[model samples]
Target: MYHDYTEPTWSAQQLLLIALLLVPAVGALLVALLPATRSRLVAVSFAAVTFVLSVLPALIRPADFGWFAYTPLDSAPVPPWIDLDLPWVPALGLEFHLGVDGVSYPLIVLTGLLTLLCCAYTPAKGLAALLLVLEVGVLGTFLALDLILFFLFFEVVLLPMYAVIAGWGGPNRRAAARKFVLYTLAGSVLLLLGVLLVVTKAGTGDLVLLAASPPLDRTTQYTAFALLAVAFAVKAPLWPLHTWLPDAHTEAPTVGSVILAGVLLKMGTYGLIRVGLSVAPDGAAWASPVLGVLAVVAIIAGALICLRQTELKRLIAYSSVGHMGFVLLGIATLSVAGIQAALLGNVAHGLITGLLFFLAGTIKDRAGTGSLNQLSGLRETAPRLAALLGFAAIASLGLPGLAGFWGEAFAVIAAVDRGGPFWTTLAAVAAVGGALTAAYFLRLLRRVTHGPATPEVRSVRPAITATEWLAWSPLILLTLAVGIAPALVLSDTALPLATLLGIQP
Candidate 1:
């Protein structure tokens, strides 16, 4: 929110936010125009170039590095302390208002980072376009201030993701994509309805205005909450709503899985915070218990499923359910620590789960399958790969010095801080989820990392290529950086977190 000029200077939001759309738009066209024979080159170049371009905004207008204390005792500004507005649709009372605050910035940076990483690791020629398109939608969703614009970005995820999964996924992909779409679509319909209801009741859909002055009666709020929550919940893939994930993750190609885990899943959690909490505080408070119970179920059930899965991709996919359960639990707490944990968890899952999928894909490439029973003794032929996998696993299992720990640890600690029978018990369940996470990772390790080589395991290949390392190293380094210095992240998030969570210090 630090801008030298109020109106004279070119806005970073103007340059950076608009660039997100333009790059992908142009990149997609360029990719399509390239000779088919250089299709691989085109895909790689488009991704690589687009990634470099993504950093321009950050380099040009570096994010302000400061913390917003959450207590009432400290003075902190509510975010977008600097704001930008451009008229796009006047009838709707909407403008292209873009600005950075504690909440949006990290999510924005994470989306940009992962999109670039995705472009790096993403290989499918036909599907890369959709991924780029998905990036546009996600980036827009995070930056958008209009309620309808936000919803558009939210639903933009539907088609491109469906196309990616259906076009590039495994044998059963069509069905998996269909199931994924049907659920999300039903949810989107409800989301649209809630949007209309809010706009009708509140007289405006501008998120800034809505957040400034949310309307609707308590009854209407709860009704809208249920509808919108169901819609976002489908995305959150919470408990019963999560049936589509394992199949989607299992069937999706590596990069597809990566984006799915890395960014798409966070959309659900993001909506919970952005739309659910921000627009429907009363409803959110009312439904917190429902979210809380479902989170507990997901934590316990997802962990148990991970323990049983024999396929590496499926295991990681299920682990997402558990990881995201903590995200929901954090949101449910309705406290700054809880919300911060959820935000932290969002970034952590993107790093850790993305790495796990990437490594799993590498193992599958060398070994010809992702089935654990068919592979063993990765240490013998691919010791370095084994080490990377170990690193990702233990980190995901919530090892203290790693990125994954904070999300889960903070969620549980925040829940404990909330100190209710429900919160305390769910905290205990999430802790068990944590322990079970460690158990399964350890189990996967025992099964795949060491001991005498089975025929399938012994056939493991050499170290990852330079390209692969480049694709993965950022995520690896980020995991360590965030884990070691979460304050760096937390500092960036403080104001937005305080504003959204209604904390003022």
Candidate 2:
């Protein structure tokens, strides 16, 4: 028997998800209203709440649903589980859309954890509000379902990060901050143009819609991809375009560097997958070989740069370039395995590199300098610190049974399995770069942690602080956990990626 039925106006679960997404922004506002002395506590509480909320969706196993609907040229109703799709500036065809899927949920959790950790670890007064604000942007970027909404969230990250660098960083902070803004803003312009072209051409800004039915023809897809690639590349800070990173890492405060390495850079790689490949598949295929070559070069070049780097933070920054290269290489292969590797690499790099920067900052703060040559014999004077540094160093160098290994190994494996002359060559070069990565990190270990105590090291006092330990333990434990069971990240990513790639899960 058939019966008339109506869907509830909105499910409680959907409303809860929307509440989770907005929690940080509301918290940021509340934080701003609080007394300066209480800001940290308020920010932490709200961040913790947001983190809890972010985790809820995973537990409940929500299905896809729509928030609000709109008329389109194609006249198809939007998909479900969109959560919020209210029309905004209907004349421009923009909507305030936000939602999540397997691809984005892990990143949302990463963003929440990193931001909370940064807030807990940072000693700078009057900054918790900004960090909370930044957290909102990072989470929103991952969850945003509309192109315009995504861009807004993406741009929201730029300003707070700039403030963090300029206000809390070291001697060269202002210059580093300016360079960061200029490079990113230039990229943002291109990103906006690309988004506009796609939305205008497709007559919709809905990412799900665009993915289901590419809005543009092949030639237009190619053009859109080119513009979008340039934008994301600058943010990924790919080789030749990567000049802004080392200085930013070196000059920014420890928390800033941690966030930069841990989550912000992921935005670029995520964009490449979410927007570039999905929206412009033909263009991505055409560009894959060239991108693979560039990824290989970035791998080698970043390692080479690390070999010459003397500053601890700069070395870690350069290391990020190489690690992210593995991610880009995996993406370039355009296979299920390659993309999965890229996803794994993305999370692993965030965890390992974040830990590395934190340790580097701790060492520098205690020793009063970051110069590897001048800072020696940490093993003798600061055994605990040296031991932690050694642990982080090995993990970052892709030691077996560490978080870094699975991603780097799988990226190379995927390239080999891709079975083309270009991919084969790229795989070989990347493997060699992996060796170079180990060498440079070993060199860093020898120069900074293994020698006789330097005068600075001998005079240093204070072990790792409670806040530092609290902030670090998660990354350290997660590194080992993921190392031992890469399936934690891989399993969640596999089906979503297969969907993205039009392959069977």
Report RMSD (Å) for each prediction in the order shown.
Answer: 2.8, 4.5
User: Residue 103 of model 1: what lDDT?
Assistant: 74
* Residues forming the 10-long window of minimal summed lDDT in candidate 2: 64-73
lDDT of candidate 1 over 55-94, digit per residue (tens): 4443444334335343222333354633557888787676
lDDT string, candidate 2, 192-309, tens digits: 9998888888888887777665758999889999999889988887777899999899999998998888889999999999888878888898898988988999999999999999
Q: Return the clash pairs for model 2, or none.
A: 64-80, 65-80, 65-81, 66-80, 66-81
- The runs of at least 3 residues in candidate 1 whose Cα sits more than 4 Å from the true structure, single-residue gaps closed, are 1-12, 37-77
Clashing residue pairs in candidate 1 are 74-505, 376-457
Count backbone clashes in candidate 1: 2
- Write down the lDDT that model 2 would get: 0.83
- Top lDDT prediction, candidate number: 2
lDDT (Cα, 0-100) at 434 in candidate 1: 92
Query: Which 10-residue span in candidate 1 carries the lowest summed lDDT?
Result: 68-77
